[model samples]
Target chain A: MPGMDMMDMSLMQACMDACAACEQACTVCSTQMMDCGPACMNCADMCNTMMRSMMRMQGMTPATMMAMLDATVAMCQYAMDKCMEHADHSEICRMCAQACKDCMDACAAMRESMMKMAS
Target chain B: MPGMDMMDMSLMQACMDACAACEQACTVCSTQMMDCGPACMNCADMCNTMMRSMMRMQGMTPATMMAMLDATVAMCQYAMDKCMEHADHSEICRMCAQACKDCMDACAAMRESMMKMAS
Candidate 1:
């Protein structure tokens, strides 16, 4: 929480909301039994982890926060890439991809703010 | 599900129970504000993801299952290592470390059975 005191609560709230929405979208998309299912499952887990970590700030160090954020970004990128492959034909995939993008952007913004606060 | 028809439901059930238990333990331990908190947080997410993925096998491939198992193992190992450092001082850390070990073993067994069934 050392670097998080200056973090805007609204941004954190938005990030958590995006993460939760992305998890739900990915869960539904994974149930479609598409090739993106595995990526969606992975992304959902990462997003949930990111959300819960944000909720429990006392449990994190700046190092761990950055690591978790990096992992989440990677997972979101992978999931979004996979979903985009089928986005043209599947509405669920399209929605999931959008959710992943939103979550990724939120997380990136959070990370950027943390870095700025640290510096 | 192609290779899962022969999976022992009892073993799968036991592994899922272990994962759920580990997740709970880790979540509680993380609130202790120890150095292990971050690791515990990561492990909790991985365990929950593992449990849910098992429940929804229709959403997974053998490759994804193996990847998830591997990630769970790594997370459990990391969390257990961190918690063990404080096990001598905190009952919660001790219990959490034990839960992580149990979950890791169960996941490994599940992966082993999956391999045998595949062969």
Candidate 2:
């Protein structure tokens, strides 16, 4: 788009994919209704929003993108932390935690790349 | 939560319910792969995020909530516009468009309430 010419398309694509995967995992994890369910639901929504905003870059500014990434990262971290509490006995929680970690790292990398491009 | 003690719970709950309903409608509409599919998908994600964030008010500041509501409103408006183009030919599009409009109105109301509370 207009303001996205300098963006790394590959990195953005990877981040979007990671967010989608995390959203799916968290959605499934939330159905367990465990202590992490609320956090998982929150993380799922944040990841879906992050992915859609990336896809709809025409509607986003760099500042708003950064803010969204920060929110997504925070949600993923909180969900991951909560999931890890049950990881010892639940395979789904373990997988969900991994997805959240992956999503968090991808969002961080996307944010860093955006900062680099702006600089 | 902490900063939301002065909030209108009934309004917030209504907005959240509207968001959830809009998300569900948009999700179903997007599977049709019509011209409005992308916008429907975007709206679905935004609505889901808006609902979940309302649920997780403990993690939000008034500023972030306002910003998010603005984004959600924009997305819903766009999706509604797109779906309206196909509304005459498609029952699903008509329903989806109605959902988007409802969501947009709900978010606008929520934003106005938040602003009033802040003032």
For this target, which candidate reaches the highest lDDT against the unseen true structure? 2
Looking at model 1, the pairs that clash are none
Off by over 4 Å in 1: A1-43, A50-89, A95-119
Candidate 1 per-residue C-alpha lDDT over B36-95 given as tens digits, one digit per residue, 9 for 90 to 100: 887898789878877887886654556557656766776787788889999999999999
Model 1, residue B12: C-alpha shift (Å): 1.0
Please provide, for model 2 over A16-97, each residue's C-alpha lDDT reduced to its tens digit, 9 standing for 90 to 100.
Answer: 9999999999999989988888778877878888887798765445665776787777778878888999999999999999
> What is the C-alpha lDDT profile of model 1 across A1-119, one tens digit per residue?
65567877788898999999999999999899998997898778768877887886654556666666766776787788889999999999999999999998998998898888889
TM-score of every model? Answer: 0.64, 0.65
Report model 1's interface C-alpha RMSD after superposition on the true interface residues: 4.8
Best by TM-score: 2
lDDT tens string, model 2, B63-97?
65776687777778888888899999999999999
lDDT for A2 in candidate 2 is 42
Q: What lDDT is reached at residue A24 by model 1?
A: 96
Look at candidate 2 and tell me the lDDT of residue A11: 91
